[model samples]
Target: MEILDHLDKLKIFIAVAQRGSISAASQELALTQPAITRAIQTLENAAGYPLFTRNRSGMQLTQGGQILFETAGRVLKEVSDATLRGAHVRTEMAGTFTIGTYESLAEYLWPDFLLKVQKDYPLINLSIRTDSQRSHLEELNNGTLDLLVDAEPRHRQNLAMWPLYTDRFSFYATKAATELNPETAKNLTLLYVRNAFDEDNVTIESHLKSAGYQFQQEYTFDSFTTVKRMAEKGLGIAVLPQRLADKEGKLKLIKAKGFKEGFGHHGIFATVSPHRENDRRIKTVVNLLRKQLS
Candidate 1:
């Protein structure tokens, strides 16, 4: 007989062994007493040996029944454990989530979102790593990161993305440097983040190139924080996301006439493997991010 055919019989056998009576087992299992007896008989026929002996007081287990009872008890315990584990995962009750994002987003966007996640999922341990967009995407593909936030979404068959928020880019410098015109400013030291360049960078570069002004790159940093620090220290004028510039409060937004189109807006996106798209933890994080962005 198929193993599946013996499952119901095994269940009844276990129940009777636990309750020590067919009547009690039947009530516990929500089956009629006769039905429980029939199930026990089916198990005996399958095993080629009787599992229980009936007495005036109740049913008692035979030697073979005792062995099967122990085995069944272990199996039932495993089944219960598996059920609970699945429920916990579905509810996002526990697990560690590794998140990756570019430096700019990590600095500007993740503070509040991290606090909210901690409040909502006390059991979920979050590990965050900040890197360049390209490196973040590579880590995500290699399973090092469960999710990634980047200025631009990666184009890959196994990855999915969604827009988080859009922010404009702007040119900024310290108030002491306000007297420098855009042309003269290009001749001064200019700090740039090579890895964090997005579509906005392209627009800004083109506008500057067309204006016959070329910036003399004095320093190149891999992080936005470094570039912002350099600009605030009066080391150079830099192009920065408007939100960061506004938050810093140390830099003044340049109001040059032709530079308006240079402030391109970018949509932040979440990147993750398609296989993990339906994971409860990932879905919860995505929902929270969407809410924060909205």
Candidate 2:
């Protein structure tokens, strides 16, 4: 006989043995008396021996029934304990959290946020990936990222985005160019990161156009690192995220008059799949970023 098939029989047998009466066990289990009697019969048949001695007043467990009672009680307790432990483990924020970010924020913001998370939740194994804004959204849709940090995109579907912070784009140049004002901004040689500003993707190009200014010498690069380095070497005034520009500490912020009036700042946001927004571990990390980076 298979032990698994007889588990219900064992449970009823244990209940009957402990209660000392079939009717009493039936009441305790909310089972009909006939059902209880049938379960006891099944237990006896499986055991190949009489389990309970029935009498007018009550029932008594035979030697085999007594042995099963002891074993079943322990088994039930162990199973229940295992279930509770499993539940506890599920509640802990101890799992992989994969986050995707753009190059600038990944370089500027994530280092301090990571330190705080490690100190608080050491068990949250973290993985960070840097991608362009468009690529980040693609990976997020394909389920490759658990959380995302980037400039606010124009469209969001099946995703929840929360505003984290705003970063302004500013012109940075060598100390010699600090004397160059907004009226002459068009005269300065300018370094541009091609991916950083596009007419459809970012507002910088339109803002610069409205100011009646244009770069006299234009150098375009693919990466912000290159843009900043070239600007530091005094090749041109580079327009980059104010935070990233500040971090370089090598260039001076050249504030043009009326420059602050045009598309000055863009919002940065934290995004997650709609279903995972409320998850404890994901929420914890998002909250940590909002708190630390705000």
Candidate 3:
């Protein structure tokens, strides 16, 4: 008779045979000693023969058991390989996965991108959290999130990153705003989005400082909505990413003073916990994003 009916028993037999002791199998499988013994007994009774021979050292496979072990191993390997292949092909997988991103991307970037994902993987549900990039990174590390889609954040250990696209910063306003440089920024109030969680504004300050960008007076708001609105009304110059600022084709660009084009550019990334780098769920989402955004 085929042992396929008792897959659990087959697994246990292989573990015991390889380890040479039921106790070792128990440790490997995280099962109790008595439980493993019961399983072995149940399997042997069905076959009308003991699969193992007892000895001073430990249990050794009987002649029939040795023959069955080889066949069982091949069957198990094939089953596992087939299952992995199914996942690799990105079909027949189900369940919801959480992805953390920024509010700007959630508004301008994800609508079309999400439609594409839904069309491709109808069963894969995505719960998108539009929070600050810093908060997303923390949630990712603390296991509250499965994946992250945002511009490059600080590299941390045990994290994996894949580039999606390069986004450049731009100056936008209702009218042709003054030239985008530190000197002109001091005259016109610099409008920028800040996360509520960023109490000290340390990250934004550091980022602007690196590019020699400084404004004597600034308009800091919690969301891009407020920043964009302020700029549209001719209140201040809005500093935003090119894709986000021009997504609707409403906002106009305010050219910079120097030969260098936009304020600066950064690579948008698909980040995840390093252990899940090759996971089918992660791979599927990342591939879709790369196709749409890159």
Candidate 4:
């Protein structure tokens, strides 16, 4: 017969021999008992020997059957592994997915997200890069980032944006700065994210101007972690998302009237390339984030 016939009969023979009963092999293969027996009979005839001896003890493999069964088991296992490998290559689950985000959010969320992703989708490798909002958006546009998690969405025509969560901005300072009076606090300097301008530069500028507050710009940094660290060290007061500040016990919130309206900003958003909007992996991640964070 053909090579396929040999392979199929060998599989059937192994199944029956391992199961020790033709009826059990047929049940496992979703075939009738007669069909399973006939397949084994055909295999034994092709090899010119009896593969198994039937008795009350079910079925026992003859000498020839033992050799074929051992060889076939390994071959089937290799074929199964190769089939799984080929399937992985054809799907998006096995490759690396690059994610971009701001440093602060990355610090807050990346650890937990990485843990969950690893536990659930172990095959999907994740690479996270932390940068400023502007740089993150640039990477998204350049196709260097498969996904972007940011506080604001880029207004590009070729990007798809989805809201993830909203967080409020609050004023925070070290315990030392908390003792400063309002007038003194105004001059204590303010640690603001340089990239906040990308969100609403004009509004912030106008608000600062109206408040007659001129911050010492000498210690400004592009990194959010640096901003938080400086603020914790009592270097200056800072305007940060309330969630981040609240999580740090060393910092205390400074509630001023009208501060919320001026400083409050948009929440987290997921940005994907227009071309990758329908990509299965991206869609799966977006959906999972929405379900988890929403």
For model 2, the stretches where C-alpha displacement exceeds 4 angstroms are: 1-91, 176-179, 194-202, 261-263
RMSD of 4: 20.0
Select the stronger candidate by lDDT from 1 and 2: 2
The list of candidate 1 runs beyond 4 A from truth reads 1-90, 132-135, 176-182, 194-196, 200-204
Highest lDDT, which number? 2
What's the CA error at residue 114 for candidate 3, in Å?
1.8
Please report the TM-score between candidate 2 and the true structure: 0.63
In model 2, where is the ten-residue run with the lowest total lDDT? 194-203
List, residue by residue over 1-294, the lDDT tens digit for candidate 4.
Answer: 533457867667766875689888888789998888878778877788888999998999898777776567545644654465566886556555788887778776777778888998887767898766666665565455779987766476768888888776667887633333346555668887644532543343455556656654536576667778889888878777766776657788776555744264646889987867887878888877776664
Candidate 1, clashing residue pairs?
none
Please write out the lDDT profile of model 3 over residues 1-294, one tens digit for every residue.
445557778778777876789889999999998888887787777667889998889999898876677567545644654565556565545555678887767887788877877887676666788876666765566445678987646566678988888876667887775567767666667888643212122344455666677777788987766787777787777877777788777778988665256645556778887756887867878888887775
Assess the local accuracy of residue 162 in candidate 4 as a C-alpha lDDT between 0 and 100.
80
Error of 1 at 99 (Å): 0.5
lDDT of 2 by residue, 76-193 (tens): 5345544654656855766666788866677778888888878887766677888666656644654456788877566688789888877777788877444445458667788866
Q: Write the residue-wise lDDT of candidate 1 on 1-294 in tens digits.
A: 533568756777766875679889988899999999888888888777888898898888899877776566445534544465566765545666778876666776788888988898776667788765666664565455778877756466768886777777667788744444556756777666544545445544555556565666657776667788888888877777777777759988776546654456666878887767887668878889889776
Rank the models by lDDT, top first.
2, 3, 1, 4
Q: Given candidate 2, what's the lDDT at residue 70?
A: 48
Q: Which of 2 and 3 is the better model by TM-score?
A: 2
Q: What's the lDDT of the predicted structure labeled candidate 1?
A: 0.71
Question: Whose TM-score is greatest here?
Answer: 2
